[model samples]
Target: MGAVINQFVINISLIFLFMSLTFYVMRTVLPIQRTSPLFVRFWFGVSNGLTAILLTINAIELGEARIDLRLIPIALSATYAGPFGAIVTLGLIFIGRMTIHGMSAPFVDAILMFIVFFLFSLVVSRVLINRVKGYAVYIGFGALLVLIQVTGSVGTGVFFNVFVPYFLMLSLGAWLCYWAAKKLETHLWMFLLHTHRATIDELTGLPNRYRTLEQMNDLEMSGKPWTLLVIDVDHFKQLNDTYGHLAGDAALRHIGQTLERNCPPSGFVGRYGGEEFLLVIEGSEDAKEVAEELVQTVRHTMFECQGEVIPMTISIGAAVAGHESSMVVFERADEALYVAKRSGRDQVRFA
Candidate 1:
């Protein structure tokens, strides 16, 4: 049994090396989807080595596998790097165990563990992170533990011996690790929520004053060339007086949706205040093109309140912020908006 254990450990080590090499090569050569090449390169270099490190630590624990903490890397990989990250990590772990242990109990154990972490990456990360809460993650962890036990029982002794004591130990350890991660994720999410709410308008779901400030600050710090468009709904006060506050609100919501849909991918559109909205267009000089597109989108969008169509038009003032402070840039656009309003309401003006 002692000799068998030693042989298994050696096999596990060799398998880890092979897994790491495979990940590295794939990362280097394959075209990873949606992620930056730099990020792909970084993940490739780190994931396998990290997995090996975790495996090495657990292997040293021998039969006493307190393996729940092993999920930290897998969870991070899946959460930050996405499904590809999870797949790479999962594949390496699976192949590593298969290579070293010759398709025995450890192989089955590895598969069960991989499945649990993979689900964590796939399901837990998507829901938990988006909800901006940690409670979901903790619940997810507890559920995963139960699932692991069931999977363990099913796969037991077909390839590996099923031991009640080991199962109990593994489950308990996993619970502890999961609980810690949940707490950490919850606090992190709370912080993100607070920040998002501060900067985003509730009704229109557009960035408010705070968010615009932040965007400007980011642009200033990065020294990136960009364009700002100040959009003011024409005759908004008159429209409000004629139609009612509720109708006006509905119209505003319609405008927000239209702007969001039509805006460039990198652009940020938000309710600046009242009937005023702002768009920060990145990496584009053709303000005329963007403003024209926005005008068309607004013209085409229909706003219905109480089964009646509320016709609306926007006066757009665009200014390029090239090596200028955000305040200065906004001032330029504001002056342009004033010009647009004075000349005619439903036209684009640039400064």
Candidate 2:
């Protein structure tokens, strides 16, 4: 009896160890968000398939019956990957059981258990989006054990000896898997937030200079025709001298908001630096028209700061990309911007 209990404990430990290793591989090796849907399905199929096979091979023996924590993988696959994944996992388990146990009473019992588990999983998947719904796996698996006992698949003595211990193991395993998955989710969200912060300007909520350059590089690599518009606020330093830096900041924020809101869908806008903004328009034949529109918008808009009405205008330089690199194109746009400022500020110049 002691040896039987010890074997059960060992089997439970091995099952959880396999589960933990699967999660570790998923966290470290798999690109969870970037993977294709077909690839995701294949991943869940292979991982949970192996888990089912492991459970079958290491099943605890009790008077001509075998018991394993196979439900853990099935429940998790369903909860995390949804119905399609649950179906795949169930099919894998069925194949594993048939290959190992052959056509017999034990095999039939396994099929019955799989059917019950699959249905329960379907119900659980709907609510699994809420973390608290995870406990349903325990109840579902517990009901599976009761079904097995009521159906007389196991003798009365073995049912009493095994049911409680197996249920306890399943409950613990389910909770651990849930905890690990939640932790991984939290870590992924934090990573995304940090990446966003690094690439976005906090004050204006626009893409920062670094992100703009990255986009420019990507656009250049695409080998498509595009345009860059460099805009500078006219008399910005003089305005700062008159109204103070806080008013200058308000002016910058207002300009960023106007450019972002009015820019065409094909265009990207960013705060290039102090009082300067960059706009990228893809596949544009109307670069001059867009530039003129932007200049007019800035010229007409009034910026309010601490009961002072500040009137502002912007000078824009437009350049089209052909055989030149992004940096060269940007430099040409900057030169056109200088020309606009020289020709008199409130207008657009093309290079």
Candidate 3:
């Protein structure tokens, strides 16, 4: 009995180690924003399959029965990755059990136990996913052990002396695995939020200068035909001085929204700094025409702040990417912007 209990302890430890490795890979290696349905299914399938294989190798033998932490993977996968992942995990465990036990009565009993657990997983997956740290999870684990014992051909004494210890170990193991996964998930979310904050403008909710420059680097690497448009709000300081900073901020926000709304599918628009914006449009034959449309849109649209209507105009400079670098093109666009401002603002100039 002591040996059996020790074996169960070993099984639990192994299960915890394997589960930690699985989550570490998920947290660090997988690409963010690319966890498609197929990818989730495949990832959970493989990870749970490995868990089952490990459990089979380290299974504790008690007279005519075999026990392991196989249920942890199934339970975690079902609750965390949904029904599809659960089904794949179940299939893998069945295959692993068959490989270990062969075609015998013990194998048949194992199959029955797995079926019972699978049904229970399906019933409680949604609840567990939402709340896995409560008394409900403990109760569910107890019920699972009861069902497995009743379904198996083991005697009452064996159930108490052997299976009960395994049940306790697995219950603690499952809770620990779930807790670690939740922590990693929270950390991932916070990391993504911090990354987003770093690359986006606070006021306009548009990509900031750093993110725009990163996109420019990507465009440069692609080596495709693209146009850069440098836009400046005409007489922005005067507008701010006359209407106050609040009105100026409102105007900038209005312009940002308009540019975002009118931006082409193949174009990127970002807040470049105070009263300035940048645009990157790909494969546009008439870049000046698009810039003119933007100028007209801003010129005609009325901005209201404190119940006062304010009209605004923008000067734009356009430059197409040639053999010159993105920064060189940007400089040329800035030069053209100066030309547009000198030739009378509220117009577009090409370089």
Candidate 4:
């Protein structure tokens, strides 16, 4: 009866440890959602489960001796999620250790390990690591880990050979994981940059018509209402004729920058076509405030070249989204812009 009770308690402990380790591994491997595809998510889940199984086997081999497997998870979380994720991973590990072994020397050791990983990884993510400047981070992390373990050994009076070898092994593993993560992160960043550039206008740095339409579709799908404002620069041809095409280009660039800076937080600006810009505004009932702001900003802008302050004013037209089709919205704004131009230049008119 005594032997059966001991076996039952040991089995229960092992199960709990295995489950905690499994959680750690899964969180590390799971996709961050922004960058991960469905297949990649599935594969990460599977790989983490397998790793948990291996860790469990190793624990059994060691006669259920307490080992700090926390660092493996922390290292992974640091590499992917950066400092915050590393801290969360560390907390999970600390909680896991306390549950598995209670408060003792080993638990203290585990807490120290978490702290070291959290601080070092925060440094790596913030200052030392990038695609080109990343090798230094790996070296720094490895050195930091070595210093921590050496200090820990000194304090604990543990067998030097055993602790030193294990520390070195873990450091090597951390280096490998960080290197892999850095490579992945670099590729992901590049992918996002390329995607953004493809969907954005080169001159205005705003989303192109395609991207704007895509966003509208997405918002519509998600049951959100939106409004569109189409703006046209009045007498753009006059500027080209008066100051030459170069000055006209300069004017466009200036206006693009200004509009980008001044648009509301829920607004998106786009370069729709030649001398024409589009804006998507959400939850804005009166486009008058926006229209007035643009009109004033454009009227006051002093374009300087060769110490000459060249002045220009723009006529703007605005339209809301739900009342019409995209084409109709643009046509209405264009009509309104014509009204502004006809009424007298340098004004905003809405339809």
lDDT by residue for model 2 over 211-303, one digit each (tens)? 998889999999999999999999999999999998888889999999999999999999898888999999769888999999999888988
The lDDT, on a scale of 0 to 1, for candidate 4 is: 0.60
Task: Please list the residue runs of candidate 2 whose C-alpha ends up more than 4 Å from where it truly belongs after superposition.
Answer: 1-156, 160-165
Instruction: Sort every candidate by TM-score, greatest first.
Output: 3, 2, 4, 1
Give candidate 4's error at residue 300 in angstroms. Answer: 2.0
Candidate 1, residue 132: lDDT:
19
lDDT of 3 by residue, 203-270 (tens): 99999999997888789889899999999999999989998998889889999998888888889999
The prediction achieving the highest TM-score against the true structure is: 3
Looking at candidate 1, the ten consecutive residues that score lowest on lDDT are: 60-69
What is the lDDT of every predicted structure here?
Answer: 0.65, 0.77, 0.77, 0.60
lDDT (10s digit) by residue, model 1, range 232-328: 9988888789888888888888888899888888788888899999998876566689898888778777877787887889999889887778899
Worst ten in a row by lDDT for model 2: 27-36
The segments of candidate 1 whose C-alpha lies over 4 angstroms from its true place after superposition are: 1-53, 56-94, 98-172
Enumerate clash totals for all models, in the order shown. 3, 0, 0, 0
Model 3 whole-model lDDT (C-alpha atoms): 0.77
lDDT of 3 at 204: 92
Q: Over the full model, what C-alpha lDDT does candidate 2 score relative to the true structure?
A: 0.77
Tell me the TM-score of each prediction against the true structure: 0.59, 0.65, 0.74, 0.61
